[model samples]
Structure formats: structure tokens, C-alpha cells
Target: MKAWQITTPESGLRLAELPDPELRGGGATLDVLAVQIPAYTADLVAGGRGGFPLPIVLGAAGIGRVTATADDVFGVRQGDIAVATGLFRSGRAAEPEEALLGWTGIGGDGRPTPTTDRMRDVWRDGLCAERALQPERTLLALPGAETYKATEQLAFLPWLGIAGAGIERAEVRAGQTVAIVGATGQLGSAAVLVALARGAAAVVAIGRNRDALDALAGLDPRVIPVALTGDRGVDGPAILAAAGPVDAVIDTLGAAPTPEPTMSAYQAIRTDGRWVLVGGVRQDLPIPYGDFMHRRLTLRGSWMCSDSTILDLWSMVRTGVLDLSLLDIQIVGLDDPAAALTAASHRHGLEIVVLMP
Candidate 1:
């Protein structure tokens, strides 16, 4: 089997012919169809985002058909189409810690752990190959997925699951207005569709790209795009003006050197409204304790999604409540990961990049 391997953080990705993965107890092997290289893959590979012990395949989310499964695995059977998000449970679902399949992605605290080598044997490999191994718990069956002619869209389920879980965590109810920061990106776009599907009276799409924001607004009349001015004080008012006082805000902006944009979103929230952080913004936020206490604002953080969350998202897609057709997907081959990574980094609007193994 051919796989893309990174020997070290500084070493670039190379296509290597590797031995097929051995099926472990309670595990399944997937004939990988398509894998999406996240926008942050390049940064992760180049050591800009700390280092991971290398000599590993690099990919997180993908959709594939089950070719083999251990006798103990019953969640999915041979020939079933499944989605893998690179997340798996070790001890129990109720346990505080979980294992991410690709890199040292995220752990118990819903944050990436500093120890890059923890679970190195399990997470050292990912879905960037012809076939990949995963615990049965990480595979979710996607019945009739082929009929949709939306393999690219199906590749986004991992992100949709994450965004959906965050929206759920915020307790966004029907007939309420919701704001999605960084709405032009993949996760943000998913949140917008989920909010609309869940019956949000209005969905505010906030981002720095005017054209992308405009494209999102074109998807639904209820979508209101608020272009960021990069100034917290100014952007806050802009968001409020467009969406009015939102009932909740889901921030999907990636790691930022400063927290101004996130803070700007914070200011747009109404009193008692919830602000959920699901993105990679790395800076520490300085919240006014007195203001938070008086306004009764609730701040929460959501990392990855659960299996139940994935099922809910799949149901929405199957029922056509969450339209996957709106996304513009770009597909590439595994031979050109650098080009794929470059394209991923410039992601905008509903454009998503998928790698075909």
C-alpha cells in the first residue's frame, strides 16, 4: 500500500510504499476513498505548531469502505461505507481521556497535549493511504452516501460533527439568532448550515472575506454576513448591527496571535448569551470579570465531536435538512500533498479540499 509519510517535523511529506496495517482486536481496516487535508496540516507538518514524533502518515478525517474487520468489531461490517475522524476511545467513553488517530490531536481537557509521543503507536498513522486501520468505535456507517454524489461533502462530516457539537453545547434553540465567527471557513460554514437546519431565526456569518461572506449570504436569506474590520471595538458593533443581539456565538477562528477578533465576537453576544469556542485561537483572552458576572455571559469550549454527534449530522444530511451541495470541493491525489496543502491553506467560502488515495 502507498502512503504519505513524514519522517520528521522538518522533513516534508513523501509518498512511500508501506506494508498494509494489521487489524487489531476490535478494529477495522478501511479502503480509504477520500481524505481531507485540513487547512492547518501544512503548519503541523512544518513544525510551526509544535512538533509531533514523525515517521507517520498525515491525515485526520476521511470516508472509506470497510474491507476488513476483526471478529469482535460489530459497529460496522465488511462493505459498509464509514467516516473516520481520527478519534477513538481507550478505556471508556466516560473516561476523561481519548486517543486521536493522526497526530497528538486533542486529549481529555479538549486541548492538544504537549506530549507528542503519547499513544505514538496508535496515532502515529492516519488515513492518508490506500487502507487505514481504526478502532470500530471511530468508524460511523454512512448508508446511501454514494447516492448523494457528494463524496466531497461527506468528507466534511468530521468538521460538521465538531461544529454541531459546539452548537449543541451552546444550547442554541429554535427561533433564536446565532453568530458564527470565521463563517467563511470549513467549520464556520458547517455551523451556519447546522444553525439554519436547527431552526435558528437568523444566522450571522462573520469573517474577514467579503466575497466569501457574500457567497454564504447567497445560500440563505436568513444568513447575514458581517465583514470584520480587524478592530474589536468596530467589529463588535458591526456584528451586532447585522445580526442584532445574537442568542449565541460559535467562534471558529483558528489560532490567533491576539484575541481581538474573538473578543470582538464576545462583545456581540447578548446578556446571558453563550459563547462557544471551537477554533484554534491560541491567545489567552482577558475577560472583564465584573462585566461577565453582571451580564451573566457563559463561555464554553468544545473540541471534537462524539459518535452521537456524527450520527445527528448524518441524519440531517440524509434528510436534506443540512444541505451538503452548497460546498465547493476541490479533489486531489496523494502524490501532490504539498499542492493540496497549499490549496487548503487558502480555503475560503464553502471550498473544501479532499485527497483521493
Candidate 2:
């Protein structure tokens, strides 16, 4: 099978022909269809994100057709379409460990531990290949995806599902306004659509990019674009003016330069509203103890989604509620990493780059 690999950070990312994986006790082999490469994939390969096992196949989450599953893998069988999410958990009840199967994500602290190291050793090869081997826990079966024509668009499922998980954590609902910070990015853009699909009366798409905001507003009349100027005082008021008393705020800002963009949107949350953090904002959020206690506000930190979240989002795509046709996707082959990596770096909302392996 041909797959992208990085023996070391100094070696960089490359395509290589590798031996087929042996079927293990809990592993499943897949014929990869389309795999969505996120904007920061280049960074991940350059060792900017974090450490992973050396001599590893480099790819994150994607959709694939199950060619075979271990006998113990009963949730899905052969000839099924499986959603291979990169996220994998240790299944421990107390402070369990987690690792992004073929990528840089380690535990919640973003630090690599002995446990996470062992986890990665077991499942280091990623989905950026003609075929892949994944643990059953990281695979979710999609019943009708076999006949789904738009495989490139369907590659965006991982992002959409993650965004939907954060939205669900915020308890977004009909007749309520929701605010999505960094709404111009891939995950944030997905959250905007999920909020709309869940029947939010209005969605405040807050971001620094004006053109992307305009694109989001064009998706629906209820989408109110708020361009951030960085000043929390001014931006907060602008967000509120656009969408009154936001019932929930999902912040998906990645590696933020400052927390102001997020805090500004935070100010618009309703008195009893919820705030969900799913992005890579590194700054410490200074929440006033008095105000938080007085307002009865809630805060949740959501990572990759649950099985139910992806299933629900898949249903929406199948039913045409969350339209895939609106997306602008660029599909590429497995041969070139330099061009594809550069293409993936331009963080345009709803503009995707996929690998058709």
C-alpha cells in the first residue's frame, strides 16, 4: 500500500510503499476512500503540534470501506463504510489516556506520556493511504456511505462531527442565538452550519476574516457576521448588537494570538448561557469569579465527538439538511505532500483539501 510517512521530523513527510498490516486482535483493515487533511497538517508533520512515534504513517481522520475486521470486532463487519476518527481512548475510568491514532495529539495536557507512547505504538499508521489498519474503538460504521457519491465532501465529516460535538455540549436549540468564534476557519465554519441545522434562531459568525464572514452570512439570513477588531469592549458590543443575548458560544479559534477574540464573544453569552471550548486557544481565560457565580453560566471543554454525534451529523448529510454541495473541496492524489501541505495551510472556511487514496 502507498501511504505518507515520516521516519523523523528531519526526514519530513513523504509517500512510501509499505507492506500490508497484519490483522491483529482488535484491528480492522480498511480501503480508504477519501481522507480530509486539516489545515495544520503541515505543522503536525514539522513537529510544531507535538511529538509522535518515529517511523509513523502521517494522516488523521477519514472515511473508508471496511475490507476486513478482527473476529472480536462486532460493531462493524466487512463491506461496511467506517468513519475512522483519529481519536482513540485508553478506556480507563480514572484519568484514562488518549491519543490521536496517527497524529500529534496526545493526552489532554498535550504532553506525551508513557501510556500515550504505548498507545501510539499500537496504531501509528494513519488514514492517508490506499489502505489502513485501525483499532475498532476509533472506527464508526456508516451504514449507507458505500453508495454516497460525494466522497470528497464526505471527508469533511470529521470536522463537522467535532464541531457538532461542541455545539451539542452547548445545548444549542431552536429560538436561541448561538455565537461561533473563529467562524471563518474549518471547524468554526462547520459549527456555524451545525448551529443552523439544529434550528438556532440566529447564528453570530464572529471572526477576523471579513470575506469568510460574508460567505457564511450568504449561507442563511439568520447568519450574522461580526468581524472582530480585537478590542473586547468593542467586539463584545458588536457581537451582541448582531445577535442579542447569545444562548451559547462555541469557540474554535486555533492557536490564538490573543484570547480577546474569544473573550469578546464570551461577553455576549446570555446570563445563564453556556460556553464550550473546542479550539486550540492557548491563553488562559480569566473569568471573573463573581460574575460567573452570579450569572449561573456554564463552561465545557469538548474534544473529539462521541459516536452519537457523528451518527447524527451523518443523518443530517444523508437527509440534505446540512448540504455538502455548498462546500468547495480540492481533491488530490497521494503522490505529492509539498503541494498538498501548502494548499491545506490556507485556512479558508468551507474550502477543503482532501486526499483520495
Candidate 3:
């Protein structure tokens, strides 16, 4: 089987021919058709900033067809199309050769066991190969969707998680105004869609790139694209003021100092409004507790959603509420995951790329 392998953090990944995995007693194997790349996340893994294991197949999401199955209870069957999410049992837990192997959960009998963890790892491995062994937990049968690309459909994993977390943290409700900082990246753009889908009255898309901002304008008349000409820290307050008093703020810019957006979040947001931090902005900076206390603002953080949240996202996709086609996506081959990762790290492109098997 042809796959990408990250030999070491410093050495990086390469396309190699590896052994194909076999179906376990209670597992299934999918013939991978497509894989998507969140270039930004991939770069982090290559640089060792992201915590993926070495020698692991590099992918976050994908689509495949089940070719074989050892268990009928898993809801996936041979010849069924499926989409995979990679957030479960990651790192040492998801390593195929590791004890956990990505499957970790309690049994139906209400007893905790290692069986669950191993099953999850098998699911993660299935995403990056021509043929893959997928656990029941990670595979979702796509009964109706017609086309699948590594970059486009694969985006459901990261972007969907971002949108879910941002909306939850912001406590978005109908008629509320929401602002998405860095609203052009994989997570940021998804934030905009989530805001719209959830019925936010106004969604402000803020970014440093004019082209990206312009790109999002057509997606919705409600999306107001604001540009950051200067540093975010230097220009954040003014930008927020221009956008008006938003009820919620979704900050996805993962940078140091985080700009002074907290001030914008404080001044523009309603007294009870929340500020959701999805990126690593100002991670090292101290928060102004005085201002936070005075404004009575809510500050929250969001990581990838729980396993169930991911499943809900799939349902959203099914309903056609989350339009992933609006996202920038490029498809590549499995052997070329490195190039996609390199581009994502630098925030180089307006689109996300998916690696196909």
C-alpha cells in the first residue's frame, strides 16, 4: 500500500510503500478513495509543534468505501461510502502499533476496556491508504453525497470542529452579531458559515488579506469582511469599532500577543456576550482582569469537539446547511502530503488541500 510516513519530527514525512493492514475480528477495511489536507495543521505536525506520532500516516480527514468487514454491528458494510474523522485517540493512543491504537472507550456492558481504544486507532489508519482498516467509531457511511475529494469533503473534520467550538463558546443565538477574527483560514472561514447556519444576524469576517476577504464576500451578504492592514495588536481595536458592537467574538488567529482584540471583544460585545478563543493568540500574554471584570465578559477556549459533536457535524453536512464548497480546497496524492503541509504552515494559500490515496 502507498502511504505517507513521518519518520521523525526533524526529518519529516515521505511517500512510501507500506504493508496493508488486515481486518480484525470486529473491524472493517475501507478502500481509501480520497483524503483532505488542512495545510496549516499538517505543517504544525511536520515542525513537531503538532503532537502526531512519527511514522504515522499523515491525514486529518478523508472519504473511502468499505471493502471488507469483520463485524456487522458497526453500521458500516462492504461497498458503503464513508467519511472519517481523525480526532479520536490521537498520538500514542492512535498509533497503530501502540496499545491504545486510537480506540478507547467503555464496552456496551458498561465496563471500561482497552478494546475500545484499539478500535479507534484502526479507524485513523484507514484514512490515508489505498486500503485501510477502520474501526466502527470513525467511519460514517455517506449514502447520498456524489463526489468526494481529499481537500473538500475531508475539511469536515477540522473546520466542522472549529465551527462547533466557536459557536458553543460564543453562545450564538439568532439575531446576535458575531465577529470572526482571522476569518479566512480553514477554521476562520468555517466559523463564518457556522455563524450563518446558527442564524446570527450579522457575521463580520476579519483578516489581513484583501483577496481572502473578497473571496468570502460572495458567500453571504451578511458577512462583512474587514482587513487588518497593520499588526492585529496595533489595529484590532479600530477594526472592531468599524464593525460595530458585536454580540459575540470568535478569535481564530493563533499568534502571539493576539493583537488587542480583547479590547474589541470587551468594548463591542454586549455586557454578557462571550469571547471564544479558537486560535493561540496572546497565549503567552497576560489577560487584563480589570477590564474583563468590569465588562463582565465571558472568555472561553475550544479544542476539537467531542466525538458526538463530529457526528452532529456530519448531519449538518447532510442537511446542506454547512457549505464546504465555499472553502478553498486543493487535492493532492497521498505521496505528496509534505507539500500540502508546508503550504498550510505558512498561511500561504486561501484554500485547504486534501491528499488523495
lDDT of each: 0.84, 0.89, 0.63
Best by lDDT: 2
lDDT by residue (tens digit), candidate 1, 1-357: 989889865678888889999988878998898887777778878876654456888777789989899999999989888998777656544655665777546566545443424654655688999889887877898877757676767888888899999899999999999999989877898899899999999999999888889889999899999988888889999888986889999999977778998888777789999999998888889899999888899999898888889888898999998888888888888787788889999877588788888
Which scores better on lDDT, 2 or 3?
Answer: 2
Better of 1 and 2 by lDDT: 2
lDDT of 3 by residue, 277-340 (tens): 7775644445678876887888887755555555666667667776666666666676565676
Q: Model 1: residues >4 Å from true position, as ranges?
A: 92-95, 109-118
lDDT of 2 by residue, 1-357 (tens): 888889877999898899987778898999999998888888878887887888988776998889988989997799999899988899997888888988888667878888888889978898888999999999999979888889888898999999999999999888889999999999999999899998999999999888889999999999999998989889999998996889999999989877788789777888999999999888999888998888899999998888899999999999999998888899999999878889989858888899998
Candidate 2 lDDT score relative to the true structure: 0.89
* Runs off by more than 4 Å, candidate 3: 72-75, 89-126, 146-151, 229-234, 255-266, 343-350
Best by TM-score: 2
